[model samples]
Target chain A: MLRYLAKKLITLVALLFFVSITVFAVLFVLPGDPAQIILGINATPEALAALRADLGLDKSFWGQYREWVGNLLAGRSHHSIHYKMPVFDLIVDSLAVTGPMALMAMGFAVLISLPLGIYAARNQNRHGDVTVMFFTQLGLATPEFWFGILLILLLSVQLGWFSAGGFPGWAADPIGAFKALLLPAFALGVIRAAILTRLTRSSMLEVLREDYVRTARAKGLRERSVIYVHALRNALIPVLTIMGLQLGQLLAGAIIIENVYFLPGLGRLVFNAIGQRDLPVVRDIVLFMAAAVVVVNFVIDVAYAYVDPRIKIN
Target chain B: MNTPLLGIEELSVGFDTPEGKARAVDRVSFALERGETLGVVGESGCGKSVTALSILGLVPSPPGVIESGAIRFENSDLIGSPPEALRRIRGRDIAMIFQEPMTSLNPVLPIGRQVAEPLMVHRGLNRKEALDQAAQWLERVKIPDARRRMGDYPHHLSGGMRQRVMIAMAMVCRPKLLIADEPTTALDVTIQAQILALMVGLKQEMGMSLLLITHNLGVVAQMAARVVVMYAGQVVEEAVVSELFGRPFHPYTRGLLRSMPDPAGRPDGGSRRLSEIPGIVPAITEAIVGCKFAGRCPHAFGRCREQAPGLFDIAGGQRARCWLSRFPERRRTDA
Candidate 1:
């Protein structure tokens, strides 16, 4: 198992290296001039040349890439033109906000989806199944942005239950931060819950039909135990697969959600960096996001073996 | 003999399908005495498993309706017992082992837990106590390394081992009656023999009656005292095992016997052109104005095609559902 995990870690590092090169190439190859964009409209060719040299844009493409990669590896400080802060520091700050939000959203999604999905599956062809299925379809059909807007309108604008947008520091005031976080988390989580719930229901329904489930019932176990203990464990493999995939999706979705909610997170940082053509900030955040996704997938792979002993890593 | 342990009188099971209400088991009646093994032999969709499920009230209601029946277990009516009362009876008074051992044992749970579940539910034993009993039952079923293997999941065991776990689960509660629905059908010939032996030994030790449902004549011959031959939702023939084997009255029973390849001799061991019953069993959806097996019986005549034959006694402790049996002349002429 250790050998397998080590191999996976090595592969992940290689994949990250490839992703970094691609991001570098794409940003460098773009037609727009970051230096000109940074400078005012009255800037001359000499000023442009000077600004380009100062930003190391005067170096050859490969040379610039090499220096950027070298500086990152060396932990050399680099300023973000967008935030006017060190790029690494900005990444860390943004991650602090985004990481917890994504995690909370995922937790909320799991808590809501698993039970609802299992219930729907057990009560298949009944009123509960129909109702849950209808809402899940609605969630899958409706975009997360629209859901976020609706939530803002209902909870923030009309109801005045929550602030329209922004994150309060949980360290400063836990109660206030929890209340502030709830709305965005709900907005991001509902869509994810819908996805996971649908997946859970279908997978559970399929697993319930397996022979083992029949055995469980024949064992004279209560219906609840049969559905939850016997059926759900096998069903979770697919649900876990979807959950892992959705974690990455949630991170991507956070970019739009954070922009709408005005949350100070990595998603917003990435968006702001993209707008300002701040390659350093963008590259670092992208790499971090990529790393997060890879790590989550690795964790999910390990969890599979735990959940299902039949899965052996050779 | 002592009053039968289980008696099903005029039992009928119907399902509400989109097409229409379809009868799966029609007036299926049988009795199992204490410590007796009654083998119910039938083809697929002959309502063998349905009958077993109905006996335990495990049949899904609404769609699956027991239109009318009296399932008397030791003179207590189980047909319309409340769910809670039925729950007590299910694993305590009567237990069942299903076909397809792989599908019948919950894969996620340890084999020990699966075996101990009935004990916990009915006996009210805690996990440790129940597990101890489960291990004992596992040993009864001849499962090796019973203590260590108790923690292993169902999928970890072989087909035969899984079935042994199933039997252990069923027998753990020490129920008066045990229903084994094709319990060894999923196993190899050797494993099948082993399972049968384990069941026989356990049945004798516990003095529990058995209702063994199977399509294998060899199993019926070896394990059963009484044989109930079912075809198209009805008992076509029922008799003492030796008598049934010696002289099967119904054409379906005859066909079943004929289909069995002789174990002691080759297929063509001087038996004049091996008997082969022509045609398939009629679909349940088809209206049964006449005998259900009439379409397949060579001796089927005008009366046989026009009216269904009800089960009738032929001799001491033997019965068959066939018009030819009503007329000895017809039987002789046909022969």
Candidate 2:
């Protein structure tokens, strides 16, 4: 098991390395003059050159990469041109807003999807299944941004139930922050819940047809226990895969959602940085997101091993 | 006959398909004495498995409707029992071991948990106690290293081992009637023999009646005392095992017997040709004004094509559904 874990760790490191290099290369390939953007359109070429040197853009590509990787290893922070602060500090500040929202949204998604998905699978081909599936199809097709906008229009503008956009410090007033986050979280979570519901339904349907499920029934277990305990565990492997992938998407997707809500989050920070061509900030955040994805996936893999004894890491 | 552990009277199962209402089991009736082994032999889609499922009320009700039936177990009708009541009776009184052991045992759960599930549900035993009993049952089934192996998942076991685990699971509750549907079909010849022997031993030890559903005549000869031959959703022939093999009155039974490959009757010294049953079994969807096997039976006559023959007693404890058996003069000699 230790050897298997070591092997997985090595593979994870390799994957992170590949992801970092690819992201770095892609960001550089995009046609953008960060120095000119920083200096302003009316600024002279000498000012631009000075800014480029200062930003390490004047250095060789490999030299810059080596310096970036070395600085990351040494915990040397990058300055965010947009925020005029350390990239780390900006990320921490944004995370304070985005982290709880993402967590709460995922929690809501799971709470809504689990029972609905199980119900759809159990009452497969009935009115319940059809209705849930129809809504799920709509959810998967409609983008989160559009859904967010719709929620803002319907619940905030017309209904007067929530604030239009912006995060109130939840620390100062927990109830106010909760009320503020609820609509945005619900908007994002509904789409996720819809996707997860579909996945859970399909996976559970397949699992229910398996011989073990029949065996469970034959064992005189109540229908509920048979469906929930025996069937759900086996079905969860596929659902977990989709959920892990979506977690990465949630982080990336939060950018748009955060922007729409005008919430201060890593997503909005990244979006603002991209618009201003803050390459250092962009590079750092992209790398951080990549790392987050890898770590989340690793946790999911470990969780799978715990849930299914048949899944030996080796 | 010890009040007959299980009795089925006028049992009929029909399904509402896209075509129409198609009867799967048409007025099929049989009795199983306590500790008796009744082998139900049939071709694919011949309603053998459906009959077994019906006994435990496991058949899906909407598509599969019990048109008419009384499945009496321990002097109580199980036909219309509530789902909750059925749950109590299912693993406690009537247990079933399904085909495809690999898929039948939940791949996610440990074999011990699968086996002990019935005990936990019916007996209300906690996990530790249930697991202890499960390990004992595994040992009873001759699974090596039962204690250690209890933690192993279904996929960790071989096909035969998995089937044994399934059998152990079914028998753990000491059900009065154990239904094994093609239990050994997924196994190789050697493992098949071992599993059959193990089932026989377990049945004898527990004094449990067994309803063995299979397409193999050899299995009937080895394990069963009485045999029911099914063809096209009907019981074509039923007789004492020895009598059924000695004198198969139904054409389907005769065809099945003849089709068994005999190693001693090899044309080449080492290889034998399997006797083939010429025509395919008729589809259930086909309109049946006459006998279901009439289209395929070599001994089918004019009346056989026009009128369906009800099961009639041919001799003591032997019944056959065939026009030729009734009127020997009308039997075809061509084949």
Highest TM-score scorer? 1
Query: After best superposition, candidate 1 residue A1: deviation in angstroms?
Result: 1.5
Question: How is the predicted docking of candidate 1 categorized under the CAPRI scheme?
Answer: medium
Off-target runs (Cα >4 Å) in candidate 1 are B60-63, B266-273, B332-335
Error of 2 at B27 (Å): 2.0
DockQ for every prediction shown: 0.54, 0.72
The candidate that wins on DockQ is 2
Give me the TM-scores of chain B across the candidates: 0.95, 0.95
How well does candidate 1 score on lDDT at residue B4?
87
lDDT of 2 by residue, A125-181 (tens): 999999999999999899988999999899989998888988778788788787777
TM-score of 2: 0.94
Residue-wise C-alpha lDDT for candidate 2, range B222-252, written one tens digit per residue: 9999999988788889999989999888888
Interface RMSD of 2: 1.0
The recovered share of true contacts, given per candidate in order, is: 0.51, 0.82
lDDT of 1 at B114: 80
